[model samples]
Target: MREITGKQITDAIKKLVIEANYKLDDALIKKFKESIEKEKSETGKRILEQIIENAEIAKDGVYPLCQDTGASVIFAYVGEEIVFKENGNGESILVSAINKGVSESYVEGYLRKSIVRDPFDRVNTKNNTPAMIVTEIVTGDKMKLVYMTKGGGCENMSLLKVLAPAAGLEGVKQFVVDTVENAHANPCPPVFVGVGVGGDFEKCAYLAKKALMRGINEKNPNPFYAEMEEDLLERINKTGVGPQGFGGTITAIAVHVEAFPCHIASLPVAVNIDCHSHRHKEIIL
Candidate 1:
């Protein structure tokens, strides 16, 4: 078995947090450029141009693309063949590494300290400690880490519904479309919609959030779902929410869906939205 040190994980997470916040992924940038060319509304096209410029400036200046630095989320896939060594702290090495990374990155990268230690007191944690970490055990020999910075505006607007199995696909489609329309300008326009279907309530919610981590314009491999995505994009744009909800076309850049097996009696669906500045990064070690 290969043994990995906690320090390595800590350092890697810190660097990823800083880098991801400052730079838009190339795939997302390409999509924005394409949108600018095809956008029907003059206002929409101008907003797309501003977004592209914001990304470029953020990368060149090493500044955050959006004012909201977001809550740090870490997804770790630990291989059964690898072992993590703790330095006699009695804490899980993995947890320690994550905390270290989060603290260091938040301070050095000038990220906002958004976490509160006590919900009642509402006191800031100062270091953005205690990252929301999700860990999975896998078959491989290496660990894979993903960092997703989720902004509060879009995250707060996410929703889930448990539909009777009788609701069927039409019900699912309407629920998603309705949720976006209800959200209006709240989640920020020009959003990326992630829809998760099937799984139980909680699982579906998680799946919806995970879907947002996909590349901006990547199509779902399932042909039916891909068509659903395309159709949803068309319908959402027709809402005329426009960029920043100023009223125009191009309200959403993409609609992604991830579904899983579920009980026959229930159809749990979730809608997770990401604003134009969807930020995430991944690394394998």
Candidate 2:
């Protein structure tokens, strides 16, 4: 078995968190440029241009792309052949290390602290600790980490609905389009829409959030879902929400759909919206 040290995980997570906030993903930048060309409205085109400029400036690491630094969300695929070494703490070494890394990155990198200790109490965490971590075991010896900085505005606008199986494909399509239409400007226009179809209630939401990690230019591997993604993108842009919801032809940069099997009785669909600065990073170690 391969043993991975706690420090290695901590250092890697710290680096990823700092970089993800400071640098916009290249795929997203390309989408912005493409969106600019597709945008017919003069105002929308200008907004897209400004977004590209902002990304350029943020690349220097002087300022983050968005004021909301976001909560650190990680999807870790750990190999069954690997084992994480204990950190001498009684708690789960992996979890503790990840949280330590996240807290340090937020504090040392000077990113805004947005996570709160409690939903009702509303006190700031100050260091953005306790990252939302999901771990899955796979076959390889290495670990693959997909890190995302999930901002509140778009996350708050995400929705899930349990449709009767009879609602079928048309229902799923309408639900996704309606969610984007109802979201309007709240999630910020020129958004990336991640749609999760099938799966149970919570699983569907998780799938929707996970869907956001796919590169903006990448399509679902399954042709069926990929075609649905394309259709959703077309339908959403036709809404004319435009850049920042100012009104234009390029409302959504891309629509990604992830699906899983579910019981025959229910079809759970989730729409997770992400603003123009859809910040995510991935690394294998």
In order, what lDDT does every prediction score? 0.88, 0.90
Compared with the true structure, model 2 gives a TM-score of: 0.98
- Which residue pairs clash within candidate 1? none
Candidate 2 per-residue lDDT over residues 184-283, each given as its tens digit? 8888788988899888998999899889888777889999899999999999989888899899998898899999999989999999999888889888
Cα error, candidate 2, residue 44 (Å):
0.2
Q: Could you tell me every candidate's TM-score relative to the true structure?
A: 0.96, 0.98
| lDDT for each residue of candidate 1 in 1-285, tens digit (9 for 90 to 100) | 989899999999998898788998988888888888778788888989999999999997467988888888888989999989757989999999989999999998888888889879988999988898988899978999989888889888889999999999889988988888788888877899999998998899888887887777688899999998898888888888888887777788899999999998999999999889988999999
Error (Å) of candidate 2 at residue 49 is: 0.6
How high a TM-score does candidate 1 get?
0.96
Compute the lDDT for candidate 2.
Answer: 0.90
Off by over 4 Å in 2: none
